[model samples]
Target: MWLKNLNTIFVVGYPIFVSIIWITGGLFSSFYRHRQSRKLLTADEEPFVSILIPAHNESDTLVAAVKSLAGLQYQHYEVVLIDDCSTDNTWELMETLAKQWAGQLAIHNLHLPINQGKASALNQGAKIAKGDYLVVIDADSLLQPDAVTQLMTTLLENPNYGAVTGKPIVRNRSTLLGRLQLLEYVAVIDLIKKAQAYLTGSITTVSGVIVAFRREALNEVGGWNPAVMTEDIDITWRMYRNKWQAAYEPRAVCWILVPERLRGLLKQRQRWSRGGLEVLITNRRGLYLNPWGQRGLLLESIVSNCWAILTAISLVAYAFQLFFLHNLSLDGNLLILMFTLNAIQFTIGFIASQEIAQLTLPELLLVPVYILYYWLINLVSCIAAISSYFVDPQRRGTWRSPDRGL
Candidate 1:
């Protein structure tokens, strides 16, 4: 009876609980906006914003990225381009772009002598930035015309908002892996971010692709940490502990290229997993002694980690039980029920993303298969990341672009 009850909780009850959170959080994210006017602030009225684009071996995509920035409708902003010792001709391309958009766009170009990773590059950019707010954009991403303007408006409206991160929709879906990633982004990443925002008034991470931060809030937290695999996650936690708020703006859209092969995808996921584990370890103390309304987020993180471990153990136990009972069945009632609930979860995610990203019908159709694919990959990645965190003390927190699909 106890085993049956545990199976029900894991298979049905937990998913229902998760779905409720997702639905309400999605609604809040979709409709909840500041009471201020919807209009984008004009140049004379708004605060100056520094747009930082950090590049490394991005010659192939630099031109398009700069061109997208050039088309921005925001007036009071400057582009600070940091070339992080690219071996390719990225510097030359950046120089050309700087000259071409010289007067039309205020461009500051800096070249590092050696590749110091993204965190160091961003820190360098922040130090010299003149704007009250700093906007970080990856060189490989293309921001919408009003992306910067929207982010700034959102940040300025709330005095406590330390940072605001934009939505990153995958742009490269030419390959099968890419298509799978598209579904994962909309169904998993986006949903969780919205839910986190709604539940805690904070998010787990400010996406590295495109995020804006108030200069003072960043300075208070000592800028960005260089030792973590993900600077974004590290900074978010710092802001939280420092009593600053982080927000997610779904309307602020940035298109990003995703890895389109299995190897590249796995590497990206592993890097994310390692970064999360690093944050968990670093913040272990804070999780125990919560301060200044930080207990909710702290408890959430601890629970999430515990849940992952328990889920893994439960699956192994269930497998052994089935084998011992000689009652293994693929077409069981529990399997069908679980599948239906997952399908409902996917549909809710698809509809939410469609409302935000304008996704097409065909992309929505792929959610069922993509859900299973991503679950297995994510589980394996989490296990690998946990092992690395404990056993591999020599691992360097570095950044390298994943393989671009053919």
Candidate 2:
């Protein structure tokens, strides 16, 4: 009876919980958009911004990415390119670019002796950054023409906003995997962020692809935590804990390359999952204390972590029963219900993609494929993350160059 009740929670409760979050996200997103349309964003003066591009074995795409930012409409900004001990010719290329675009672009280059991970490199850059705001950009990210202006303007508008993250549009969508990821980013990531921002006035993770931070807030939180794998996420929570606020600027879009192969995608997802778990584990005290009304955010984290664990256990038990007991019968209603819930989610995602991502009607035809691909990949990655946590909990958060789909 206990086993049956537990299975019911996994099969039914999970989907119901997901539906609530998605629906809430949709409603909140709509409200946010409505409210935002009424406001006029006027910039009295442009704040000095420092763009921090951290690269590690990113030679193939670094130059193009940097070039894209050179055309940013924002006038008062400098680019600081940090090569985190790249084994390849990344630093050499950066040095060349710095010399060439010296006057045109106030570009500076920094090379590290050893690869101490992205967080450390960002910290070193922050120490020397002369701008009032520090904008972190991934080496493979192409910022939109007005990305800098949009980000800085948003930050300037609200002094409470400690950091602002831009919308990351997947650029390389030629392959099937890339296309699926594009949909995921738009339908899933984009919508959820909007909703989270509206409901809690906070988001789970800041898009590390391109995000701007005020120097004051950065100093208050002591910058990025090198101990965590996802420095973006770590810093976001830290900002909240320190009485600082973060916001999402959907209009400030940054084009980024997503993993095109299954292996690359899985590795990326696993790392994200592991990082999320690490944050939740390390910040358990914050959840109980509920300082500054962070209980909602903390509760969301706890529920998500529990859901992952429950899902893993449920899957293993079901598989065991199926192999041992030939009498095992699949729950037809539960399967149908799951599919129905997923269809509802796909519809919400489709609507969001159309409005925010500007995805055409023809592109909507790939919804089913995306649903299957992402669902399966996420499940596998969840299991892998949980396994990694148990097996190597004490492992240091280190840098490993992901397959850039080059």
Candidate 3:
């Protein structure tokens, strides 16, 4: 009876396909990014750039974020900080910075009557921007002095490149949770970003931490959709569809403060996962029209991620069924052996190969814990997707809070 049902469940429940999708998709991306990173423009061509930062109740960290930009190696730049009607001192803080910099920094403060989202603030900033290039940055994020120079240099040196994503180093790596997030950050943003850069011309979300776009591209794409929860992702898809190319020049570095606690990290990840589902769904037209979209984006995205969620969920459900409900039966030894072999294969074949240098023996020893975290994050992503299903334009405060630096 069990072997009979195994056929049905194996077809539905076997998560091997999920691993294959991620691995192959990841390999393509990683290979492409490797080549791109190897080839870069050595010549220096700095274009005047406009930095658009949206702030909301960021008084605690806004000044540092703004001041950090002043140190940029690329001197031709303007800093426009939008105070998106914060009840906090973020506005007053920006006022002080504006006064201190005076003529040295081209600073403009647009205080919204009420709280609007980051997209709206960015649209307003882009309207009055006085530069050939525009960069969207988060308040809590700080660009390295050379980050803008490298990113803008990529655009100036290569006219074909549409946008560039800067390398983001975790700022809060003090606590164990922070350290764990830091590792996760490397795995996701650093490693995965490299893959996207290589494969499919669609590097979906450039970190709000630091992403630069050509003025023409941003204007052509029409600023950002105030209604789009993840305007960053929306713009990327539009850019790709319009035939513009995006690049990942890791030389562009930005420091960002990750959540110190697991719960805070969960909220941020949940927001991103939910927001990403919105992006993938919203751009279904572009994905479907192109044949590669089926294998590359739509089918791969929906099927692969859905299975990842199901795998994590099923593992727990089976445990409950076997222990409490006594509704499922299996060879515990074979099952344990099966997972142990798969775990070893996955870590050594992939995780170790990619993160070996950074993930020490002790860190590698923590793979089991990391897997739990990974599953939790994926489950949260599914929840976020479910949430997006119910709320199209989910109203969660202003879309992009003022850069008071959260």
Candidate 4:
């Protein structure tokens, strides 16, 4: 009876409880944002921003990214493109763009002799960057004209903020996988960030693809950690440990490509999951000693990992009951309640994100599929990440160009 009760609470009760928190917090955040006026900076108030693009074998997508940067509405900014010893023509492409936009924009190119990871390249870029504020974007990302302006304004307005992360809108929706990711980004990823910020005054992690960091904060936190699987998650927690706040700015938008294939998507998710797990392991001391508000974020991460493990175990138990004992104890009502909660969560997220995301009716119809995909992918990735961590605990943070959707 005790075992059954434990299973029921973890499998059904915990998810419902967390979902409600996310939905309530997300709704409140949406309304709050709607009421607030847009904050814009005057010419004198604008700060110089150094935009860093770290590329490793990103020749295929680098040009378009640089071109998009050229059109940024923010005036006092320079572009620093770092090629991390790519085997492809990424270096040559960077040089060409530097010359092409030489007179028009303050474009600078840096090339590494050996292949270092993204974090190392970023550290190098920061050493030579002239701006007081640094914005990092992936080589495959296309920044909206007002993205830098929005990120900088939010960071500047928040006197205690160490870093600010923007929303990443999926631009590749041509395939079923891509469309699923699009909904996941809007309904799950973006909503969770807003909810986390609303509830705890700090976020779990920043979207490294398009985040702006204050130079002082970066210096205090020792910049990015190349040893971790995900530098973004590690840095966010480090800043929090050192008494710096991290914020989420939904208005700052960046169009990005997602993997359109299952293999690529799984790889990406596994890397993300591994990075998160690594941070949790490395920062476990903070759970007990950290006096800041970030303890909530750490507790949430622990709950999530426990939930994944329990969910996997429950699935296995259910299969055994069905096959060997010819007994299935699944509760129909509990399943219905879970589904209803998920539907409500997605509805709230869609409403909050529709304006910026331009969500369509057809995409709305994919909620059911998206829900199943979300659970399954997260389960598999979480399990795989755990296995990988135990197998190779000292894995270096190296990356390859991800599958850009066709």
Candidate 5:
């Protein structure tokens, strides 16, 4: 009798324990690095920065997007908006913005005779970028006033920090969905990133909206390639392998629009998922038992991505216990306690993210219950990965933001 329910405990408890372990390690690591990141704020001789904006057809918000950057406190910078063969009036918009901010922003209005993709567009923009640092942002994103100054200052203080990412706040989060994203943004834009900072100071992904890297660093990797679906992630990994550490400065924030509708959300998530898989497949060697780079960061990435597989194994054991083992009567107290523990963990995440301004109160509270809603993203990503594995898109250089552009 005692042994009958033992299988259930073993099935669930182990994975839960493992998840806690992962979070705990990340949390402690983050706590330590938060201090280090803060110290990377020495008065910089505001480095020259070339802001890269690659758009397909972001006619709706491209002007406002450029306006945010045009007024950066750091006077030594240029905004280069690349037009990636848009059928819309996006090129016209870029032309207008270029002239309007003529001296301040050196607009690299590029229309690849054919639509190559964001990767190509960024490469094109980077080729002409004449700044000490290269900063990339999406068309729907806007930077904070001090964003440029903060980023350069951070790097100036931390010479070892090859790339520094700013915080991403969900802009136009007026709707329920938008509000949800705004709420969720805080956790991701801050806490988790903070955790990633200490674990290896080598985050696997960087927000395109606001990430600045040394020009030489990008040159070292030979620029963005179409092969890497998620050019941002690919670049981050490359920086790590090349012994370039990354830092996250939540103080430098950018407001970005989230996919307003479900369809848009799916497309956006699919792209991210597809890109993640592509990154993993291409850089698997660099991350796993590689001779180069810091060991801790590689280990963290491997564990995080491999968590899905680890969870799958536990679920399999749970299925067997319930069906074949006929262990229909598991202890209620144990189950309750285990779930409550998970609840506490989720609460901590909610509290952490919420306190850090990443998630809304409701989103944090609802994170567990919204399994069907959010889990679909994981499923879709898996699907995208499968699709990419078989039929790789024709080096489609342009990345269509989930809801915006062509």
Candidate 6:
């Protein structure tokens, strides 16, 4: 009886509880941000921003990315294009662009002899960056005209904020998979960040696709850790440990491509999952010592990972019970409650993100599938990440161009 009750709580109650928290927190954050967006914010001073693009064989996307930066409304910025030892013509393209934009915009082209990784590339760029604020964007990213301005406004307003991450909007939605990912980005990723920032006052991780960092904060944290798989996640935690706040600015939007195919999506999720696990493992001591500080960000990470493991086990046990034991006791009401809560959360998310995401009516049809999609992906990736972490813990954090959707 005790075991059954525990199972029930894990299977039903836990998800409901988490859903409620996210819903309330997300709604509160959304409304607050909506109100804040109405106010006019003027920066007292224009700080020089170094836009860093770390590329490894990203020749196809680099030109478009640089072109996007050239249209930014913000002034006092330079582009630092770091070619991480690309075998292709990425270097040549960078040189050509550098010469073309020489008079218009300050373009610095740095090339690495050997492929160290994204983190290494960023560190190298930072050393040569002339800006007080550093904005890091992926090679495939297309920044909005005012993205840097918005990020800078938020960072400058909050003197304690060390970093601010922008929202990533999926640009390629031609395929069904891409559309589904677009929904995920709006409903799950963006919603969760809003809730996290509202509830905890600090986000778990900054979106690496588009994020701004203060030079002083980066210096204090000792820059990006080259050993970690996800430098973004690691740097956020490091800032937290060093008493620096991190923020999520939804207005600072960046258009990025998502993996359209299942294989590509799996590979991407696996890398993300593994990087998360790596961060947790590396910062176990700090988390242990300061479990409740920073609103228990590290503690929440540990809980979320454990929940994923238990969820996988629960599914297997349910299968075994139904097939072998022939005594599957499913709670219909509980399932309904879970579904309803998830629907409510997604609805709130959609409404909050509608302005920025420009969500369509057709995309709304995939809400049910979207919910189930994330659950399956999360479970599979978590299990794979755990396995990979134990098997190849010493794997170098390198870079590879991911599947840019059609």
Name the best candidate (by lDDT): 4
Q: Where is model 6 poorest over a 10-residue stretch in terms of lDDT?
A: 36-45
Separately for all candidates shown, the number of backbone clashes (residues 3 or more apart, or on different chains) is 0, 0, 11, 0, 13, 0
The candidate with the higher lDDT, 1 or 6, is 6
Residue pair clashes in candidate 1: none
lDDT (Cα atoms) of all candidates against the true structure: 0.79, 0.81, 0.66, 0.88, 0.67, 0.87
Please give, for residues 109-194, the per-residue lDDT of candidate 3 as tens digits: 77776776878888887887898789878888777777887787676666777788787766665576665565565544465565
Candidate 5: tens digits of C-alpha lDDT, residues 270-305: 677667666666666765554433454455545544
Candidate that beats the other on TM-score, 3 or 6, i.e. the better one: 6
Model 3 segments more than 4 A misplaced: 1-44, 291-295, 312-316, 325-365, 391-406
TM-score of each: 0.90, 0.92, 0.81, 0.97, 0.80, 0.95
Q: lDDT by residue for model 6 over 1-406, one digit each (tens)?
A: 8887687777677778878878888889978987874432344467889999999988889889999998988878999999999989999999999998888889999999989899999999999999989999999999998899889989988889999999999989899889888888887788888888998887889999999999999999999999988899989988888889999999899999899999999888988898888888777887656436454767766877887888888889889999999978878888899888988877887887787778877777888888788778888988888888999999878877669874
User: 3 or 4, which is superior by TM-score?
Assistant: 4
Name the regions of candidate 1 deviating beyond 4 angstroms.
1-8, 11-16, 33-37, 288-294, 311-337, 404-406
Ranking of all candidate structures by their lDDT, best first? 4, 6, 2, 1, 5, 3
How should the candidates be ordered by TM-score, best one leading?
4, 6, 2, 1, 3, 5
- Across 1-406, the per-residue lDDT of candidate 4 in tens digits comes to 8888778777777768888888888889988988998867766788899999999989888989989998888888999999998988999999999999998788888999877698999999999899989999999899998998889999988889999999999988888899989888888898889999998888889998999999999999998888988889989989988888899999899999999889998988899999999988888998887755578888888888888888999899889999999998877787788888988988887887787888887777898898899889998998889989999999998767668885
Superior candidate under lDDT, 1 versus 3: 1
Error of 1 at 100 (Å): 2.0
- Model 4, position 251, has a per-residue lDDT of 88
RMSD of 1: 2.8
Q: Candidates 2 and 6: which is better by TM-score?
A: 6
Clashing pairs in 2: none
Pairs in steric clash, model 6: none
